[model samples]
Target: MIQIPSKIQKIIGNEKYIIDNVGMSGSSVYVFEDKVLKIQAAGSESENEYLMMKWLQGKLLIPEVLAYEKDDSKSYLLMSRISGAMACDDYYMKAPELLTDLLAKAIHMLWEVDISDCPSIINLDKKLEMARYNVEHDLVDMENVQPDTFGGDGFKNPKELLEWLIENRPEEDLVLSHGDLCLPNIFFMGKDVSGFIDLGKICIADRYQDIALCYRSLSNNFKGIYGRAACEGLDTDKFFEKLDVKPDWKKIRYYILLDELF
Candidate 1:
C-alpha cells in the first residue's frame, strides 16, 4: 500500500458508477470511464492481492494495476476495466452449457499458472491457520452460511466446524487456485474468457478449493438462490464432465464446509 493521491476520495459517492457487486469483502468499488477502483481497509489479504496481480501480469487475463495507494486506514486499487460481462450475467446463466465450459476453462487457466515462484500460498494448512483465528475471534459470518450448517442439523457451532475441518482434512492436489472462484468473480467476452477480478484470495491452494466454490456458485445461480432464480438450475454433473475429472463429492463437501470458517 503506497501513499496515493486524494483523487479517489472525491469519487467515493459520486454517481458516475458505483459497483454494487462488492460482495462480502467489506469493500466499496467505484467505476470511472476506463478504470475501476476498489477501496478496502488495510490488511494482508488486500496487500497480497496487489502482489498477485503484479505477478500475474502476463500469466492470465487479469486486470492491469494502474495504481495502488494507501492512506492511514484504507487501501485503494485502481485498475483498467476488464472488458466483458460477469459469468453470472443472465445471458450466460441461460446458456448453461456455454457457462459451464467457460468456467471449466477458467479453472484450467488458473491451474496452469506456474507456482515455482508464487508469492502467496494458502494451502489447506495455511487456510486453517486463519480459520482458527476467525473462529476464536467470532469473525466468521454465521448468517451467510447454508441451512443447517450450524446448530441442530449441522455442527454445534463455528468452533466445532473448524475442528471437524482440521480433523478430517483431506490430501491436497496443490495448484494455483482462485480461493473464491464463484461465477461473479469470472468474466467472459462472447464465448471466450476475458479476465478474472478479485485477487485477494488467489493462491496455490488445493485444487478442490476452487472446484467446490465453482460448484456452489453454479448451483446457487441456477436455483435462483442468489441473483436470479437458477437457470433451470443447470445440472452440476455437466460441469464435472467438462473437466473430465471424476466428482470428488467427499472432498468437495469438505472444502465447501471448510470455507464456512472464512
Candidate 2:
C-alpha cells in the first residue's frame, strides 16, 4: 500500500481519494473521485507521459496533468480522469462492429494529427536502441511476454530477436503513432473515441507501430487471449476493412516482436 506524499496532497487539496487499481504492470495507480494518481519507480516514463499529455492537449482528447512530483526514487503524477469506460469493456465488446469502427477511427485520428513539431521521436532506430539496452541490461520480464516470443519455436532470446529486427528494417511509412495503442489505453464515449491514456511512448513513427499493437489487442480481447470469453462473430478482417487497409502480416509481426522487448 503506497501512500501519497503529504506535501503533494496539500497542493491537490485533501479529498479522501478512493483507490482505483487499474492498468498494466510496473506502476501503482489510485483513482480518486475525479482524478488518477500514478506512482512509479523514479526515472520512469511518468515525466514523458506528463510532458506528452501537455503537448497533446489541443490536438486530442486526453487527460489533463494536474500535478507532477519526482524524488530520487519515485515519480508521482496526478491527472484528471477522462470520461467514459475502456473501449474493451463488456458493453463495447458486445457491440463488436461499433467497437471495430471506433478503433479504425482512432487510428485515423492519430494519423491525421500534425507532426511537424512533435517532440517525441519513436522511429525504428530509436525504439530498437531502447530494446537493445533492455536486452543488455537484462531488464525484460521474460515470464509475462507473449508466449511465442521465447521457446523452441521462436528466437532463442531477446538478443536474437534484436538482431533479426536490425537486419530486416522495413521502409518507413511515417505517421503520428500512439506507441502503446492497446485496447485498455483507449476510452470510448458512445460510438466515438473519448480519449487515449498511457501516452508515455506517443511519438512520430511508422503507422504500423500503432496498427500492429492495436491489432494484437483486438485479437487478444475478442479471441480470448487475455482469459475473457471470446466474442462470437468477431473477425479481424472486419477490422482491416474498417481501417481501409490490406493486411501486412510481416510488418505487423515485426512490430509485435519489437514490443516484446519493452
For candidate 2, lDDT tens digit of each residue in 118-197?
A: 87777888889899999999988797688878878999999999999999999889888888999999999887898998
Local accuracy of candidate 1 as per-residue lDDT tens digits, 1-262:
2234666544333436656554777888777766788888989889999999999999999999988888788889888889888999988988988999999999999988999999898988889999999999999998889786888779999999998998999998999998999988999999999999999999889999999998988887777886466467486888899987799999999989988888
Best by TM-score: 2
The alpha-carbon lDDT assigned to residue 158 of candidate 1 equals 94
RMSD of 1: 2.9
Model 2 residue-pair collision total: 1
Name the runs in model 2 displaced over 4 angstroms: 1-7
- What TM-score quantifies how close candidate 2 is to the native fold? 0.94
TM-scores across all candidates?
0.93, 0.94
How many clashes does each candidate structure show, in the order listed? Answer: 6, 1
Cα error, residue 258 of model 2, in Å, equals 0.4
For every candidate, C-alpha RMSD to the true structure in Å: 2.9, 1.6
Off by over 4 Å in 1: 1-4, 7-15
Residue 173, model 1, lDDT: 92
Cα lDDT, all candidates: 0.86, 0.85
